[model samples]
Target: MKRALYQRLTELYNAYVDTFREADGKLPPMMELKRIHTAHVVANARLIAEGEGFDAETTHACDAAALLHDTGRYEQLKRYNTFRDADSVDHAVFSHDIVKEKGWLDGDPHRESILAAVLYHNRRDLPDGLDALTLAAAQTVRDADKLDIFRVLEHQITTTDWRHNSQAFWNLPTTARPNPVVLDDIRSGRPVAYQDIRSLADFVLIQVGWIRNGLAYATTRRLCAERGHLAFRRDFLHQLTDDPAVDELCQYAELPTQGVS
Candidate 1:
């Protein structure tokens, strides 16, 4: 049953990608970026599920949720020309609606759990009282989603040409300094809200700050270290900021020890 469900999900994902493929056999850069990111999240989700010793059925459900978690991103980019939820619609809600409207999970026995996971994967906080199965699935997707985001951020920071993808920088000025309020939230061990991000430096600080509130599994932390994501972000932040306070915040975040297993 798990194998069959996995196969069905692969087919659905392929069809979705086909929708965005250009007639000339190319996807717009953003579409391709998201498509590839979704693939990584699926792989990361499976790794988390296996590390957690989930049964085949639970693992399959989690994988489905990961694949569909960003289904709304493509549409959001097309409709709003941006990925910022504040500037546009909430992508999570849009994804949940698309899953239902398309009946993507209608016949699955774990449909409710899958949908719930996708809907809450991007939320600031998961609601109270989610059933154990739903919570596990949601948390799995959330961790996997965040793990890959670090990979994306690492790539974006290194590549350095924002012209092709201004949205990736949230259109904040690259020269702008970090907002103190945003820094305070991170210092308090909380994830910074989108509204508080006023500049590229604040954005980077929030990404580093995610280490405090975004992680959901021990295995995810190990994976972040193994993938060199933790070290990359730490180094990138050091290069981007000269303020001693930002350095202290990075230290407080425990930027992962370098060369330590």
Candidate 2:
């Protein structure tokens, strides 16, 4: 995980994605979006690692993990023409397999940890009993991933018609009422389960749920706040529907998350 090694991985990542872009006249819009997202996630990972004062080796390892975390996405789109895991494969696991098959992590001291982090990055909850370094690496990428996702999700919600981006919105109704289970999860301070979300309004609330309870580091939370991600979410939610639950969840979203203030 030295500086030179990290540079090598960066090159490898870019070249890997470039193959897909080169084959087509231009990358598909969704593919291009993921390419951009991988870069931003890497940047966000570095921000969190440095903000948390990770040592050089650990920080470099984290950055490598971030860069390779989405390795399977290109192939996923090619094979299934959709990003939905329920319809195809778990992209995280698919990413993990690609990393392994390519031997991309070979010779890196933190290779296994990075693989573990990639595999678990999209899980509903990380399993308990992971080693400390592995846990930190996983949590760093997960938070980093979410930090950028707020930006991506906000852009998609605000700029485009959700009707056309059904895959991104779980093909749920754009104006349907939030699911009762989703509302309960918010009121009770639990992460919103993807299975419970039945509408775009519910989908937006899932992001707020991330604000209230999902981010893993205070620095990540601060970055989220500084970016006004949560504020935009609040505005977006009201547009979807007027409900007392939105008001309640908004209050919790404002309360300072526990940990380094």
Candidate 3:
């Protein structure tokens, strides 16, 4: 019964995504990002449920929660370019509102919990009173989200398109010097300030920094290892150990793997 409803919700979500893409005409780069994120969330939820011994039915609910976790982010990004919860409005709150307004999670036993998870997924901390099921689902989704972000940044850096150039995507300043806080965060294993990033290189370093702290699941860590983020960590080691500024980043195409563990 619940599984069927989750399927319907997924179908609707995909339709909404398609419509959003068509209406926008030439989807933004982040659209690919959202798709990738949703996929990872779903996969991560499946892994978590399987490892935790969830039955087939229970696993389906976790998967549904993961799929819908970021549905609000699509609409939020459509209206605002930045993903910063503070710079614009909080995407999580907006996501909760959008899900309810659209009836995206209606009529499912897991609906309220899923909505709650989505609302707080990107938040600095989780709220109180979440039962074990909902809490696990939300944690899976968050870990999956961060894991994929690491993959995205690793891809961007390896491909040398860190600049995010062209009109379709925002021309992120990728060539500017790194900020002191950015370096400090990299060394201390903390979340980087989005505003402190001066160039694409710094942004890449910041993305890698997240793995050290925000990630929660072993599966996420395994996936990140497979993607070769450890190699990326090497650059941070050099930056923190030898030169904080990483003078002449152009000379180094790939970072060494020192700060990853």
Highest TM-score: which candidate?
Answer: 2
Give candidate 3's TM-score: 0.73
Per-residue lDDT of model 3, residues 1-261, tens digit only: 877887898898888878667555655777768877788768867876776677765666678767877776777777887775676788777767877888877777777777777777887678778887777777777776776666665565456543356222245554455577786776666667666766545665665555555556555565666676655655643543344344333223233332222
Ranking by TM-score: 2, 1, 3
Q: Worst lDDT window (10 residues) for model 1?
A: 252-261
lDDT of 2 by residue, 70-132 (tens): 889999999999888889999999999998988878888888889999999999889999887
Estimated TM-score for each candidate: 0.89, 0.92, 0.73
Candidate 1 residues 57-158, lDDT tens each?
788889999999989998898889988788999898999899888887878989999999989988888999998788889999998998989888878877
* Candidate 2 residue pairs that clash: none
Reference-based lDDT, each prediction: 0.81, 0.86, 0.65
| Residue 46 shift from truth in candidate 1, angstroms | 1.0
- The runs of at least 3 residues in candidate 3 whose Cα sits more than 4 Å from the true structure, single-residue gaps closed, are 21-33, 55-58, 81-87, 163-180, 186-190, 199-201, 233-261
Model 3 steric clash pairs: 173-199, 174-199, 174-200, 234-256, 234-257, 234-258, 235-256
Candidate 1 deviates by what RMSD?
Answer: 3.4
- Stretches of candidate 2 exceeding 4 Å from the true structure: 23-25, 163-168, 259-261
Ten contiguous residues with the weakest lDDT in model 2? 252-261
TM-score, prediction 1: 0.89
